[model samples]
Target chain A: DAGVTQSPTHLIKTRGQHVTLRCSPISGHKSVSWYQQVLGQGPQFIFQYYEKEERGRGNFPDRFSARQFPNYSSELNVNALLLGDSALYLCASSSATKLFFGSGTQLSVL
Target chain B: QKEVEQDPGPLSVPEGAIVSLNCTYSNSAFQYFMWYRQYSRKGPELLMYTYSSGNKEDGRFTAQVDKSSKYISLFIRDSQPSDSATYLCAMMSAGGTSYGKLTFGQGTILTVHP
Candidate 1:
């Protein structure tokens, strides 16, 4: 079976641009969470969504938002991206048990 | 200080050597602890997990938590080149502000030479 999958494995954008990263959870998983991992740092929580609704969010700026679809897929959107936004965007699937993660979407803001 | 603290070691060791990684936390509320391994250009993958205190072992990996001291550790035996990666410690609490929310430590980079 397929594990968590994320789209646009790599993307490059200019500062002030917007970016949307997609994630398809493991076939039957219901919850999806997002994390940002900058170079030389651990992954930081961004948002968590379940049943198409946001269950929790991290301390990220309002510019970072996310939504889960009825099909259990999810998307992370970042508006007015800054150079600091350069990081790996990870998507993890959960179900109150443990989390299984995707390979991650590497985003680079110039 | 950050809720969780870890040594970002570019720790290098020969194959078959033992490896030890650790992290300490400031949030006493954190009860569930975990270790994740991340390879280059990939998401972090769960390596081991523990609750509150004590130890848990799986094959070549061992996870230990000391809630009383707010400290945790992960150990690997017979390490190989494939073991090279970044190790991250994460934790969450059962209630309060950190409930169901994990705070992470700066990851440690490990290299197991073949």
Candidate 2:
């Protein structure tokens, strides 16, 4: 079976621009979580959605937001991007005991 | 202090050697422990997971947890070059409001020489 998949494997945005990254969960998976990983650092949690509802959120600024669709796919949006927002964004889907991750979207804000 | 702490090692070892990676935590409420391996530019992949404290072994990989000391370890026996990557330690609380929110370590980089 296919694993979690993310789109626009790479992205480059200018400061003050808006960007959206997408993810598709594994079949039958109901939970989708977003993370931001900066160079040389572990992934930091962003948002988590389960059953189309927001289940949890991290310490990110209000400019960062996400939503899960009826199909269990998710989109992460960043508005008024800053250079500090440049990082690789990862998405994960959960099973009973573990989470399956996607290749991630590499976002570079210039 | 960070919730989870791991040495950011670019440790290099020869093939067939035993490799040991470790992490320490400051959160006593964390009940689920996990290890993940991430390659450059890719997402992390789940490796081993344990609940509570004890040791679990699978094939060449073994995971050990010591709740009393808030310590965990992953041991890879007979390491291979393909095993080179970043290893991350993660944990979370169980049966509470923070369940499923994984806190991660800084990750350790391992390189096995052929």
Candidate 3:
């Protein structure tokens, strides 16, 4: 089966702009999570949704938000973007314990 | 301090050499430890996982977790050039809202030269 898939493999935005990234979880998966990875660093957790409910949130600012749909797809939206926001946004799907990740969307803020 | 600390080693070693990677965590509640391999421009892929405190081996990779010390390790034996990539250590609590939330460490970059 296909693995977790993310849309808009890459994006370029300006400061104060807003951007939305999408993710489609694997079939039969009900959990989706978002993470941000800066250059030369490991990924930082942003938000996690299970069964279409917000299960957990990380130490991100209010500018970052996410939601999961009934079909288990998820969208991560960032408002008033800053140059610091340029990074790879990754989406992962989980069944119970293990998580499978997507290629991620690379966002560049100019 | 970060919840998890790992040596971000741009380690270079010859193929067939043994490789050792480690991470130290501050959260005592973390019960599950995992190691992931990520190539450039790609998301991390789970490599090894261990529960509580013990050692688990799969193929040439072995993972160890020590709850008392809040330390974990991943060892690669007879390493090949294909093993070159960034290695990340992740931890998770047993249940509750933290069940699926993973805390990751700074990735260690490995280069196995042939």
| Model 1 clashing residue pairs (backbone) | none
- Which residue runs of candidate 1 sit more than 4 Å off their true CA positions? B95-100
lDDT of 3 by residue, B1-114 (tens): 999999998999999999999999999988888999999999899999888999999999999998988889999999999999999999999886886689999999999999
Q: Provide the lowest-lDDT 10-residue window in model 1 chain A.
A: A92-101
Indicate which candidate wins on TM-score: 3
Worst 10 residues of 3 chain B by lDDT: B92-101
Residue B110: error of model 3 in Å? 0.3
Query: Reference contacts recovered by each candidate, as fractions?
Result: 0.57, 0.51, 0.69
lDDT tens readout by residue for model 1, B1-114: 788999998899999999999998998777789999989888889899787799999999999998888889999999989999999998877743233356789999999988
TM (chain A) per model: 0.98, 0.98, 0.99
How would you encode candidate 1's per-residue C-alpha lDDT over A1-110 as one tens digit per residue?
99999999999999999999999998888888899989899888998888887878998999999999999999999999999999999998976646778999999999
TM-score of 1: 0.95
User: On a 0 to 1 TM-score scale, where does candidate 3 land against the true structure?
Assistant: 0.98
Candidate 2 local Cα displacement, residue A18, angstroms: 0.3
